[model samples]
Target: MSQVFIVTDSTADIPDELVAKYQIHVVPLRVVFDQETYLDGIELSPATFYEKLGKAKVLPTTSQPSPVEFMNVYSQILNDHPGSQIVSIHLSSGMSGTYQSALLGKSMLEDEQTAEITVIDSKSASYGYGLLALHAAQLAQAGKNAEEIEAAVLKLHEQRKLYFLVDTLEYLQKGGRIGKASAVLGTLLNIKPVLSIDNEGIIYAVEKIRGQKKAMERIIQMFEQDFAGQRINIAVGHTANPASAETFISLIETRFELGEVVYPNIGAVIGSHVGFGTIAIFVWPA
Candidate 1:
């Protein structure tokens, strides 16, 4: 492996195969149900989490990894690589404390140890930043240094755009991430909400559509206006809704040229907040 190691949290929702192929290091978050807690994607799979969520009496809660947790992972990577660089990319700080925890984790290291770690707040979620981590690893494998890889990833982040089509408002409202979107709650059952993380990484509603089909179409339309026919790398993140995600990808292909495409299940930490049938589409110029 290259001397530069790319690290990201489970909230990235990167598929297991890609993580293994790229050897990306993932620091998992946690999902809690009553008295039980499980690592985001390690102890609990997205499929299993949704099943438990459906049968549970209370809504499950999610927690960020502690600073010690991050430190342990960092220390291990350094021990193994000896003088390697780590770029720990994480979930949006506006959405969770995970990003802050990572920063604190780096601070806990000695001055010499701290110089090798760079923690970045993705200011994006799921495969939005997951795509960046993947790209960073690809750059590392190409013999690019940490500084060059980080600069490329940051530029990619600025070019990226993502939208989440939530099937219901119940999860968002319950998870306390409703924010200004609370105004759209309690509407008719068919009113699907289109949500996106803003520049500051806060989840906000783009629009409330009358149906799922229309909502997805509006999402594509928004992307068209954003990219305007540039060749792009795209990803589709879903909470156990692959069929819908596939259909959405076909529609996207008709509009813009695609470079690489990734389809990953939205993990438990994020799934608990979006609930089932949530489809998120992320796009960045290739």
Candidate 2:
């Protein structure tokens, strides 16, 4: 094992393959469908969650894991990897309290677990945060110390760009995330919304277009503005539409040279809020 380890919450939407390859520990959030609840990505798979979402009468809700859950995960990591240090990356505190929970968990740790564990609010969501955790894992695997890995992760978190294109605004409206009632009516009238998270990690509508193609094209144009003349690390995530994601990625490749493009299904936690037919893309320096 490496001298350092990485941990993140389910909100990161990291691909299983990469998580397995890096041995990144993931603590799951809870997804509740009325009376039923399941751990995000544990008892609930993305495919099953999306399928149920399409047919459910009511939308599911999500809750962050408790401090006990995080503490247990921290303890398990220390138990499994005896002298290793930990960097616990998590979803933005603005979106959820998972980061604060991690911090509390770390504080409650035994003396041995105290000095080695560091909790970070990624200040981004989906694979935007996933890539940050991945970068830390890479550094850890290369034998970098915890402090060095953390410094690199924070720098990347600041530079990461994330934008999502939703098929409708109903989810945002119903979830009370969209403040304007007009936006909800606009969605019913067939307006696609391009959204991005602010520095505070709250989602905001960047553009509203009449058609899906125009919205996607506009997103591509925005990508060119940020990543033009340089290679970038790109990650594309979807609620359930892989075909749309693949086609969008093809268009992106034609516009800019990419180092590697990771495709991960949007997890149950994010899916519950974004609804179906949402395609989000994240970009950063390679």
lDDT of 1 by residue, 1-286 (tens): 3498998999999999989999999999999999899999999999899999899999999999999999998988988988899988999998899999999998888888889998989988888899999999898888888898889999988888999888787898999877768888744868887888888888888888988888889999998899895998889988876898899999889988999888889999999888888899998887
**How high is the CA lDDT of each candidate model?**
0.89, 0.85
Query: TM-score of the candidate numbered 1?
Result: 0.96
lDDT of 2 by residue, 148-194 (tens): 99999988878778888877677776666554323435475578777
Which candidate should be chosen as best, given TM-score against the real structure? 1
Tell me the TM-score of model 2: 0.94
lDDT at 221, model 1 = 92
* Candidate 2 residue pairs in backbone clash: none
